[model samples]
Target chain A: MGESLRIYAKLVGAQGRAQASYRTSFWLDLIGSSIIVGADLIAVLVIFSRVPALGGFSISQTLVFFGIALTAFSIADLVVGNIERMRNYVRMGTLDAMLIRPLGVLPQLLANDVGFRRAGRVVYAGAVYVVALSYADIDWTPGRVVLVVSAPLFGAVFFAAFFVATATVAIWWVESGELANALTYGGRDLTSYPISIYGGWFRRMFAFGLGFAFVAYYPGLALLGDPDPLGGPAWLGWASPLVGIAASGVAALIWRTGVRHYRSTGS
Target chain B: MGLVTATTDRVTIRNFAEFASLIGAIAASGFRRFWTYRQATVAALATNTMFGFLRTYVMLAMAALTPVVAGYTGPQLAAYVWTGQGLLGVVMLWGYADLADRIRSGDVVTDLLRPIHPVLNYLAVDLGRAAHGMIFRFLPPVAVGVIVFDMYLPQDLSTYPLFAISVLLAVIVCFACRYLVNASAFWLLDHRGVVMVWLFVSGLFGGLYFPIRFLPQWAALLIWLGTPGPSMLQAPMDIFVERDPFRVQLAIVGVQVFWAVLMLWACHVVQRRAERKMVIQGG
Candidate 1:
């Protein structure tokens, strides 16, 4: 395992260095990527401008949700987001090359093109998360403090699982990127706010059916010491780590099945 | 004298007829070219519709707090979100880099060699793409909104034609804005930074994430008067929802017209200057 980790680090390090070689272009991309987080933050602020609270949470409370979601999504996107390019690999017959390598296919693909540019999102969102925590009224306990520190990490795992699982679908369907985006990015957008703002089947499907509620909503509730407005159990807020592990298991199984099922383009 | 005047008129008419046919042919080709990407169209439609639901819920939540926020009631906000989602594809606020690519590769010279002006040629093609988007991409989310929510619909009969005109001007203005950004490649040789800035500015100020009316009145007025951003999406959406009074709607359309003309003129000047520089890379 140590050897594998070292090899993966070397591979990803090479690519990162190559990208950073273009200092001006790399910095521009980094700055440009951060603007996406800025835009999303502004959207949240605009909605809060007219109303004191959204879905029974104050602006600072909602910012906690937003910060967690954005930070987690950014970390996931920075790490394994390039896995979505599985379609390109399958289409261009590059998966065949990766299959012959000693490294695990998932690790090799994860290291294929690490998007260091997305690091800006992590920094930006992390700053926002810090500021939000300062402003939000929280009853700090050992458990609450632990959850605050670990929630985004667990949320990252859940979202990373989402990226891998959805990307596995591209092995069968090459043009499924945007459709996958509907779930992956859609889930991020959904979790950025209190799920109570949504109603009917949409809320149930995305929040409970897909396990997105555990990413930020329940955790935010745990942090803010509020019960779920929809009457979900209070313990649900602490279930993020468990949900993340379960999601990772499911994603790994899906990825294994997909890799076995892949038939190359045979060009 | 009468005979000479009639002959000149006939010559001008013949030239106009030929130009019209040229534009029609280019636009038809653009429509057919985009139609070939069947999977992409479907995938984009699905994504757009999903975002429509997400945005609509957020807007509805805001409206629940107050009867109206930023002069938009619940149904009006719903209408704005759905139509803005639909028009997102039609106006195409970003991701068009074909001109920049051609400029970088030195293939844009071929465009200058063509008989028609490059601006007009590309504009025709974009109009064709917008027409295709209107049918395929614009209608589905709107149809979903109508079915799922209590959306605002215009009661006035004339609003239909007025909205159409507003949308058309918006397309032209947006195409001109993108053209200027792409044409920067003639000088920089790689205008990716420009494209990135364009994406950020246009999406934020262009009212894609949320309505510009949601901003402070002074800021909104400045964007309206100074930039072509809001004229691209917000004006048409407000017109479609009848968010403003009739005179204000007319004024909105009028501002769109001014921006459209000014932008097109800017594109013309930029293209002329670019032709003079004519730096062909990678010979």
Candidate 2:
């Protein structure tokens, strides 16, 4: 495991160096990515400007929700986001090249382009999360403290799992990139607000069935010590890490099944 | 000098009909090119429809708290979200960098050598793409919205023609904005930075995320008058939803026309300047 970690670090470091080699472009991209985070924040602010509350959550509480969702999504984007490029790898016969290498396909693909620029999103979202936490009026408790720290981590893991599992569909369906985006990016947008804003089966399917609620909503509710407006179980907030694990398990299985079935394009 | 003037004038008059045909052909080819990607259209339709649902729900929830927010009722907001989703592709707020790619690869030289102006060529093609998007990408989400939500439809008979005009001008204004961003490749070599900034500006100010009218009146007025952002998405949507009175709707379309002309003029100026200072990178 140590040896594998070292190898993966080396590969990622190489990608980081390559990207940083273009200093101006790298800085521009970093700033540009942070600006995207700003846009999302501004959208939340604009909505709140019109209405005092969104689905029972105040602006500050929604900020906490947005920050968590953004941080997790951005971190996932920085790490395994390029997994969505599976279609291109398949199209260009790069997967066949990876198959010949000793390294695992998933690790190689993850480290292929580290997207250090996306780190700007992490930094920006982290600042938002911290600022929102200060204003969120949470009661101090050890469990809550642990939840604050673990929420983003587990949320990142959950989002990364979504990325991988959705990207795996490219193995069977090459033109599935947009469909995957509908889930991953779409899922991020869905969780950025209070889940109570959505009603009926749409809310249930995404929040509970797909486990996006654990990413931000329940966690935010737990931090605020507010009962779920939708009347979900109280323990649901702490269930993020568990959901993260289950999602990872499902994603890994899907990825393995895809790789096994992958028939590379014949050059 | 008199003979030269006469010859130039005659040539201009002669080429007018030919240029119109050329633009039509280019636009048709653009339409056909996008139409070939049937699967892509379907996938994009699915994605747009999904976001439409998410956005519509949020708008409805906000409206539930107040009967109206920022002059928009729940039904009006729903119309805004659904039509915005449909117009998302029609106006194409982002993800068009083909011109930049060609510029980087030095293939833009061919564009310059062509008798037609590059701005006009690309504008024609974009219009064609918008035409295709109108039929495919614009309809599905909107159809779904009408079925699923209480969408506001304009009651006035003349609103249809006015909205269509607004949308056409929107496509032109958006095309010009994107053209200017892509044209920056002439100077920047890699215009990804410009593209990124464009995405941020257009997504936020172009009213893709939410209605600009939701802002304080002064801020919305500033965005509407100072930038082409509202002309791209918000104007047509407001017109469609009849968010304002009939005269105000007419004024909105008027603003779109103003921006469309101004932006196209800016594109022409930028293209001229870029051509004068053209330096092929990797020669």
Candidate 3:
């Protein structure tokens, strides 16, 4: 395990060097991505102010939600920046090199490109969360603080699992790249919102089927000291991280199956 | 001479068959490509989905203040948010990234040498991707929206024709605007900064994140006429919601034609100037 981690570190270092090599393009991308997401967030805040309160939540509460979701997303992008390049690796036949490396293949793949572009997102999210903390009415408890930090970790694991699952299918088929994007990108798009607004059945699918609700919505409910937006049991919020872990496990199993299949297929 | 003509005809047929077969192959390959990188696909989808979640929460929080704004309910608002997010992958006709890369790599010259008109080829490629993207990106969100919220699909059958026309117009206008932005690369060389400004301005004027109707009346009117964002998105949404066939049809087709003609003229002017500039720079 330690050897695997060391290998992962070295791979990550190489990717970081690659990004540093193109300083201008890297900075431009980082700024551009940040501006795009920042604009979206500001637009929401502006529009929300025009209305009384969105979906029965106060401005303060909404701010907290955004803060939490953005924080999780930034961290996810930061860690899995390299994994997102699975398609390019597959198309370029670079995955073969990683497979030949002495370490576990997944770690090398995961560490290949830690996206510094997401640094902008992480900075912005951290700022928003700080601002939210200053204003939000939630009780200040050790448990709450732990949940805030850990929420993003679980969110990252859950999302990374989604990424791995999508890429594993590449072992069998090349065109699966676009199809896999539907799940990962589609899930990200769906989860950024308050899950309750999507209606009960949609929430149920995320909660029970895809298991994304655990990372954001249910935990969000627990943080708010409120019932689940989709009428789920209140206790599920505390247990939501387990769902994230389980999703990761399922992704790993699928990945193993896909890798075995790949070995057999000789692609 | 007769034999030569017959052989030429045969060659043309064979080339057409090859082209058709290539397209089919790419389509088939796209599916497997997506399946293979399934987790990465999920990550991309999750990125979009996460945005949807944040926007929905914001919209829901806003709906608490008012029930109806511009004739849309809370669920309808949520539908628009998710649908627009879905459309991002579809309507990505002209990404500034490509323009920057092409310019930096000096590949724009080769693009000019293509026999079939560079602009048309670009449009064709974009349309193909948009066609595929519209299916995969949108179907899930729309389906989820329908099953979850029962958001209204057009009830008036006649409105479907109007929607189709509006969508076609939207596509043309969007493509033209993209070309205009890309053409800037010829002059700017490094269009990164300029494209950023353009995107920021368009997002505001285009009703990308929120409908222009939410803007104050005078500001919204200015946006409607000039920015071309409403033409790309809001007009279609209007058709879906109001089904005001006469006004909707007129608005879509008329504006699309105007933008297409205007943009083509701009492109012609730019093309001449850019050719001269490139010769001077030995680009």
List the candidate numbers ranked by DockQ, top first.
2, 1, 3
Candidate 2: segments with Cα more than 4 A from true spot: B1-15, B279-283
**Which residue ranges in model 3 land beyond 4 Å of their true spot?**
A1-7, A46-55, A229-235, A263-267, B1-67, B73-117, B120-162, B184-208, B243-245, B248-253, B281-283
User: What TM-score results for chain B when candidate 2 is compared with the true chain B?
Assistant: 0.93
lDDT of 1 by residue, A1-267 (tens): 999999999999999999999988899889888886688899999888888888888899999999899989999999998988988898899999999998999999999899999899899989999999889978899999899979999999999999999899888888764777887888889999999999799988888988999999999999988888899988998999999999999999999999999998896
Judged by DockQ, which candidate is best? 2
Stretch of 10 with least lDDT, candidate 3 chain B:
B1-10
Docking level of model 1: medium
TM-score of candidate 1 relative to the true fold: 0.95
Tell me, by TM-score, which candidate is best.
2
Alpha carbon lDDT at B219, candidate 2: 95
For each candidate in the order shown, give its overall lDDT on alpha carbons: 0.88, 0.88, 0.65
Worst 10 residues of 2 chain B by lDDT: B1-10
Tens digits of per-residue lDDT for model 2, A56-111: 88999898899889888988888888888988898788899888988898998998
Two-way DockQ contest, 1 vs 3, winner: 1
With candidate 2 superimposed using the best TM-score fit, by how many Å does residue A102's alpha carbon deviate from the native?
1.2
Q: How many backbone collisions does model 3 have?
A: 68
Q: Summarize candidate 3's per-residue lDDT along B179-222 as a digit string, tens digits.
A: 77877887764566667766776666556577777777787778
